[model samples]
Target: MAKINWKPGNMLYPLPAVLVSCGNNKDNYNIITIAWTGTICTNPPMTYISVRPNRYSYNIIKETKEFVINLTCENLVKAVDYCGVKSGKDINKFSEMNLTIEKATKIDAPLIAESPVNIECIVKDIVKLGSHDMFIAEVVAVNADDQYIDKNNKFHLDKSNPICYSHGTYFSLGKKLGTFGYSVAKKPKKKYRKK
Candidate 1:
């Protein structure tokens, strides 16, 4: 196959579409849909979300220095898109979207009750990039819906049918290819039975 060179740009697609909740009080509570977010560290549990400086929730999160990243699923696609387009400054997103606000344990920001997982974070640093500012935060707490948890304590995140953003459109995750490290994993040997 022949290859063609293209201009340098953010080609990374299929990113998690999350609803980031911010504000310290009920009046200021707001939600901003974000696709530019991901886990940065595991040892201390860190994550980052990038938002334009002009975004309504940008200053809310900056001032409070905390936010909750609510994982989006198929059921939340409409609300996610609505929150992304509408400015929180002009309207109350939670009420308009018909989403419930569950108080977070370790942070002032409220969690989206409809989300399967809510990750509470406290801003550690702010990196000002060109178009957007990146908020680097430490994960203070994580709340998972009890319904998604099995008796074995395993979280069925896939069952939630999480959605992702690719290029300029949204898509649902496809079928499971395999579990981690399945290629090099050892296979059980065949046992001989008594003849």
Candidate 2:
């Protein structure tokens, strides 16, 4: 095998492209598309989202200490891209993107109704990293589109065609290969046919 050396950088790609909505009031509500976010803990249901201090929504989130992470899908690619590039300080992102603002149950931040899933989060801590500040939050509530929920209550997230960010490009999630523990599961046994 051959390898090439490279400088230290953020090489982690294929991250969830989520629209983080923030603000305490309707006048200041805004959305900022973020790829730098993920679950930090499972038991406590914690997550984190990194944002640049210069971003318009950054201050809103910091001051309010609350936000909603709206999972993006193929249908929201255009709006996601626009929210990422445009400044909320100059314009209302929800209105500009023509996205519906659904009321969050646990938080004041509005959820993107078009999104398949909306995770309501309350900031627990703030870590100032270089370039971006990380907001570590506890998941207060989650809202999934009823259409994607099965009768068994299992969420078909993949069916929503979730989108991700890689480097500077966006991509849709591919086909599922296997479920967790598939490698170690016991195989089915066959019985001999009766003569």
Candidate 3:
């Protein structure tokens, strides 16, 4: 076995690649691909997304105090990367990328119609970090595509082929091993037959 030492940096990989939509209306909407997003709390449901201060969508969301976190799938990989690299100041992302802006149930920012799941959030606070600003938001509503729901009323989000950001690449979600709590859960014993 060999060992090596490395400088500290952001080595956390396999993060949720989400398209955050923010603007006053559909006419001025913009989508910014973000990997620095995650759930923060459970009560009242909160999440956080880190954005650079100079990004186009940053000001829009800061002023509006609302945005939609649309989960990206393998099908949206192109648009997702495009949105991240390009600035809204130069182009109309929704129209240029052929994305639809559906009305949000509880926010000004519209949801991405192509996304399988749209999470509406209202920014509760903003923390200024060195490189990026973190927008801590409270989840207002969640809209899921009806097609992903099974006949049993269970939401099959895993079947959507979700995409994730790792290092600098995008990847489709891998196979599932077991449900939560399966590791320590006791297995039922089988009845023995007379030999």
Q: In candidate 2, which residue pairs clash?
A: none
Off by over 4 Å in 1: none
Candidate 2: residue 61 Cα off by (Å): 0.5
Cα lDDT tens digits, model 3, 24-135, are: 8766689999999999999989999999999999999999999999998989999999999999988999999999989999988999999999999999999999899999
- In candidate 3, list every pair of residues with a backbone clash: none
**Tens digit of per-residue lDDT, candidate 1, span 81-165:** 9999999999999999999999999999999999999999999999999999999999999999989899999999999999999
Per residue, candidate 2 scores C-alpha lDDT tens digits across 108-195 of 9999999999999999999999899999999999999999989998889999999999989999988889999999999889988999
Model 2 regions lying over 4 Å from their true place: none
RMSD (Å) per prediction = 0.9, 0.9, 1.3
| Arranged by lDDT, best first | 1, 2, 3
Model 1 residue 116 lDDT? 95
Off by over 4 Å in 3: 193-195
All candidates' TM-scores?
A: 0.97, 0.97, 0.96
For model 3, where is the 10-residue window of minimal lDDT? 22-31
lDDT for model 1, on a 0 to 1 scale?
0.96
Report clashes for each candidate as comma-separated counts: 0, 0, 0
